[model samples]
Target chain A: MDRRDFIRTAAGTGAVLAARPGAFVRDLYAFQETANLSHVEARYYIKLPDREIECQLCPRKCRLGDKERGYCGVRENDGGTYYTLVYGKACARNIDPVEKKPFFHVLPGTAALSIASAGCNVNCKFCQNWEISQVRAEQVTAYDFPPRDVAAAAEANRCPSIAYTYSEPTVFYEYMFDTAVEARRRNIRSLVVTGGLINPEPLEALTKVVDAIKIDLKAFTQAFYKDYVRGDLAPVLEAIKLVARQKIWLEIVYLVIPTLNDEPEEVRKMARWILKEVGPGVPLHFTRFTPMYLIKNLPPTPLSTLRSLRKIALDEGLQYVYTGNIPGDEGENTWCPTCRTLLIRRNGFAVEENAIKGGACPSCRNPVPGIWA
Target chain B: MTESLVVIVRGRGVRSRGGEIAPAVLARIYERGLGLLTGQTGAEEALRTLFAPSDKVGIKINAIAGRELTSPPAVTLPFAGLFSRIGIADRNVVIWDRTNRELRAAGYALNADGPGPRILGTDTAGVGYDAEPFVHRNIASRISAVLTDRVTASVSFAILKDHGLAGVTAGMKNYFGAIHNPNKYHDDHCDPFVAELFDAPPVRTRHRLTVLDALVVQCHRGPAFHAAWAAPAESLIFGTDPVAVDAAGWRLVERLRKEKGLPTLAEEGRPPLYLQTAERLGLGRAAEADIRLLEDEV
Candidate 1:
């Protein structure tokens, strides 16, 4: 059988998939069926002698031999030149609501033309999209969506912004950067959804193009990053700092697993850090964790756990703290910090109402920080 | 504890500058190596000692480097022919690798049906990785169905080369192709991960032998083929002990590198620590004192 047929058969038997969390059970996305990989030469790599290259894309700095791929599985060192096999080769694409990216602060109530290629820099144990993120470029079926075509598709679909999402966009830096550049030429905004595991130079360059960036800050502790995420927390923290310094919109999402990262002390520490470093205006989302991929043993984060964490962040003097993955919760809506009026009411990925006018609270005229234009 | 036995069989003109491998010379090398490895008087007897007549044998070959540096068809096909001579059906024997494209580039005819030896790849239609991951230490990866489902016994028929990270790629490192996420295990010079992966049930329980293709060894800057560094070793190395065979292969690469006036892999800070890791796991011998070397001429 072909890959498509094999997946279908496996799905019918409930043999291929791990136990998914509740939110994923309600929304099952279909896998694409065309493994059209690209061989475009990558950016942000250092060519070494003897046909080896050091990838400077993420913190891994993977020094690869000729014909060897990096940890990301999408980039390879071919005869001393590093190339991204997923460049402009999108494996997942859809017009998702802007809040699904959890960018409540940017372009609320608008549709985002979201796209992702196969592979990610970090291997998160609880990865929801492991079928795409954990495979090589050739393993997944992908489409050849070039930068110009991506920009055109976003414009044609009436999406106000293009989101580089679903999988980590850092591994597809060249594709995302060029696509953002093309989108800018058409007066369309570009956004990024990432794990923030990129190097400073590339992250700095990317901020100049993308209008907003939603960083999934998995956890605060280095142990959590090393064990669960297979990445370093310092670089992500550094990336958050760098993005906040720029004019681009920045938001952080921390997935609170039940027993892993939901401790009150750690949550308070993270909230205080955000308050000090990134300021209180930046939206901090406490998204619920799901049982997926390698970490299938853990249960979903409890609502009380999420609510308590949100209370701690708000109590720590953060402005726009929100809870995610819980439909019809009051925390899903954005309440103005000054007047306590709901600026944007959201349920799941759908927006019920948006009350902000000219980037300020409609009730008290308090200057709420966002890209509302 | 007995020393692990490794046989090195050589042919004077096994490889030509025109990229042609002498099939007759390769056949002799395979015969001698298998005879010594199994303590058998003949090739067919050696095969009988290693596998049952009802067993489906999978000869997993390394073809990631394409035609330039891979397990040559000239060498592997003759080896498969020996299994057929031992009363194992040709349909029960599979000569396979990771992808069909790599197998085709390595000059293998893609044969899955109406087959003699069932030459194909893991990516062939109706064949893919196992649905669930085989979670070994530091590795959660999907294994190719050819190894997990199709084969009862496995032979790692690998091309020996100087790896930029692992210091040497031989029998043990060749199994990296069997997993879906080898890219994740390359860090720390592939130490412990390679050994740990081999210790996983799918590979450890079924593995029967290791055959190293040393005819055209890439001694420097490989896993990839570089003409200046590629040396025609004109030999095949065989053993039941995966670590000992790879340890022996490392010596060959170091010898070639020394001849070219380059630093040893140890001096370059990239020794194949996985061999020692494998030894610690009680998988096989890695040290010279624990390995018995035997040489023969074809």
Candidate 2:
């Protein structure tokens, strides 16, 4: 049978078996499909002396032998040929509010065609979507959703933007980039909901096509990142800086965990860094963290914690500091940086009233930094 | 720890006219190796020593590299057949790997046959992974239900080969088949992770033996098949101590590499650090002084 039929049959049947925490991460060693995964030659990699290859996709720089996969569990080296297995093979697809992506400043309250393929560079302990995100390309059910089909679906669904989200978009860069190009052709915007752990070359190219990018800052201290995220904070910071510098409407979301990353001192440091790097105007959302994945022992971030962090960020001169995942909290509304008028009134992803006229505050006429159309 | 006895049993002309295993020689190989491992007694007592009659044994095979370089059905099925004849119920034995396609490629008949030892992959329709992840140390993964809920004991029936990154892929590294995220653990020449993973309860508690399929050892440019570098070792290595078994397997690969005038895995700077880590964890002895190696041919 064709892979498409196989996937449908596999997923349609009881094949969607409940997973036990395997001996290690959710790489799905048992879902051994053939080279059904894409062999589209990857962009960032160098040929070694023998028939080996080094993947320069992320910080791992996984120097793989003939048939080994990278740390991301997606890319591979086949006789010195590097390839990404999860190019167009999306595992998760949903119509999500752009606010859920927490792109507070970019086209708020619009529905986005959000999609993700399996695999990620970093393994986050608190990943809510580990069932799909932490698995290998073949482990998760893959569909034949190529670039054009993705764009067509977004247009059909009345979505103004396509968001590469849920899983790390960097693992599926080629597919996301192609879809971004296709979406651009159809006059639909492409937004990247990423952890921002990608290398510079890919990120630079992605910014050229995507309209906006929302980065999950994860944590402030490198130690916290190293311990919890299994990824470095420096590269993520570098990515955010690159996105901000390219003037690609960038936003940052820092999920506020109770004790893990919720230290007021660290929050203040992150806030100060943001002010210095992206300036005060770029939207920053301090999201509430829910206990999930491997971190079930920790309690979810309290409502008061999000409020206090928002206060801290606002105090540090971040103009559009907001509290997320908590509905109808005063921090949900965007106040004009100049006149302090509520420019965008939001109540749980629904735009109550837009007071900005032509991308500017109606009262003060100060330009609000966003895609106002 | 008990005396870790590992026997490398080589069969005369083990590979047939078409490059597949000679079933007669293959059967004798298991018989002879099991005989040595069970104190020169026989295969029946060996099976008893390894598993109880009521034990539902999972024979985890490595079939990722395809037929020639993978743990072939010819080698694995005959071993399971030996266990079945020795009074372990056929229904209690399963010869498995990560996926059906690779199992099929390696000449395994993917079966859910109720009457006999079944040959299957984790992707079998009703079985996938556990709904919740089991976190052990640095590992957080969705384990296959076949392992968690189906099998009572496990055996890593892995292929021995020269790994480009991890120095050598043997019995210990073979448990990579058991986890969802083997890819994540390949960093640092797959050092403490492999050792630590074996220490995890799901593996450390349930594991019973290490059977390395060394008949067509990929001594170089592996765990993938490279005909230029592949050798006909025509042997299988068996041991109760997982670390000693893998450490011994590493030596075999190094021997083959030295024969080929190639750099030792250590010279290449990718010695199996898992052996050292495994030693430190007191999993088993890695240095030669601690191991007792026995060799024979069927």
Candidate 3:
């Protein structure tokens, strides 16, 4: 594929064309022949004897020997010092609607300048952006988009917020944290889209900079996590609770897959846990699942499944629950918990009307919890 | 049942003081190893017995740790030259690893065209990893095009070393370089994943031989370079059974570790359990009793 195909501006939408799941080439880019890797020393790693180091950035805490990379395929251990290879290397960058990140409650009807480097801590079987997330940094073409440049581009594009998205942002924690600092200096909000596999210390540091975070809670059971996601469910749950405890706005997306995580009892239990731990005000998005990456045997989740799961979450006392990936559905609209009035009308990513005035419901005058400008 | 044979050919002065392989001694070691492996008097006869004349062969080398501890070209090139002597076209053989940088760091000149045994990496312009993942058991990864598309037959030419996670990385673990995401499989001491990755169609169907470069074995604190723990074994191990070869290499590592007063891999809680998993999958024998090791010095 041509390198130009990776970076293109869409007509009229002002959204750069996002590279799809198969757009990446498995070969290293020609410029990467000399290895265009970053040498910035990583944080949260302990030096061991004999030139080994244990990375404490995420739940994996990967102990690596000299010249070995972590599970993320980006960070490396060179002579007892850990360094991130993807710092300031942008593999995918685009201007997207904040709703595209599925953060309906935070900065809706605005553009988010989204960026991601190559690598993810976990290997989710159903990764939709595997082209960018599942491969090593050299396998995909990357540009030198530094932290300052990222914030400048967001301002130039008139984007209110900059999103560390597409790939797992936590894998590029240093880059994301520094960019968030730069974006905050420019009065631009920063948003994070991640799998929530980060350790508490890093998450606490990250919470101090970013304005909003959307965690993709893959499943509730450890078995589902082991079988499909190749990660531990408990750490993800802990990360979500940790982020929720902070002052930053938090949202959750649970992709409901058939015969995997769509059991009614499991969904009910997850909803109840979220209600009790994260409270009812946090918006929960039950997104539809499509067959992608390593999981092609299963079909796209039926619209009925998303609705039922959303109903389970709503019945468990979540104030703002929405169904995603099925366009024009009524479940996409947010309703006031007090009087059942439509607080925000949304068709796919397009917002028709939002009746929440000054972070309160117009009809019932109940407090709606979100970042309303 | 007959025991599987694993030949250990030792060279008296194969490794020079500068850590470079002496080409003549390395060739002698390979000749002796291949002769014993095929029960033939000549290396060319042994090559002819193992591979067809028209086969496009891939000499997959381990170069992840750079030149310090890698399968050097001085060892593998002469070994590939044996195939050329036996009528396999020089243009049909490619000595490759995961990346050009790693291969270059391992002292290999990058050559993708016009020569004997085209030395290159999977990152070569026309040779990358296959776009579609070859899913097998718990493995869903893109195999290198060198293994999946370009070469009809393969030889795993790997450096023997003690791995931090895999306990001991040998012939089978060498194929980890054949995929795009080896970092994902390093969990659980590389058990079942290493065996399962080898069981994948792209690897299992094409693999023909395991020639381990044991000139300098890093028995402790490795798969990396630690000068204090490295031993100059000056040997080349050859076997047709992939698991049996790695199992023997594991014993060699354990021997060195014991000599240095280090704990056994099992005592350290990382014993390349993948060999047993491979045995269960009918890949090869892992037990020492099932293997017949023949040692001879060149």
Best by TM-score: 3
Q: Please list the C-alpha lDDT of all candidates, in the order they appear.
A: 0.87, 0.83, 0.88
Best by lDDT: 3
- After aligning candidate 2 to the native by TM-score, how far in Å is the CA of B6 from where it should be? 1.7
Quick one: ranking by DockQ, best first? 3, 1, 2
DockQ of every candidate structure: 0.38, 0.38, 0.57
Better of 1 and 2 by TM-score: 1
lDDT of 2 by residue, A1-373 (tens): 3335433543442233334444322344434443347879988899985678987777778888776888888888877899989888877776678888878877877888878888898889889777667877887766668899888888877789999988899888889999999999999999998999988988998999999999999999899888899889999999999999995799999998888899998999999999998899888898888888888898879999999989999999989999898889898999998888888889888888888788898898889998867
Per-candidate count of clashing residue pairs (backbone under 3 Å): 2, 16, 0
TM-scores for every predicted model? 0.94, 0.93, 0.97
Query: How would the candidate models be sorted by TM-score, starting from the highest?
Result: 3, 1, 2
Q: Which digits, one per residue and each the tens of the lDDT, describe model 1 over residues A95-139?
A: 678999989988888988888888988888899888778878877
TM (chain A) per model = 0.91, 0.91, 0.94
Q: What is the lDDT of candidate 2?
A: 0.83
The deviation in Å at residue A102 for candidate 3 is 0.7
Clashing residue pairs, backbone N/CA/C < 3 A, model 1: A1-B126, A34-A142
Cα error, candidate 2, residue A230 (Å):
0.7
Candidate 1 lDDT score relative to the true structure: 0.87
Give interface RMSD for all predictions. 6.3, 5.5, 2.4
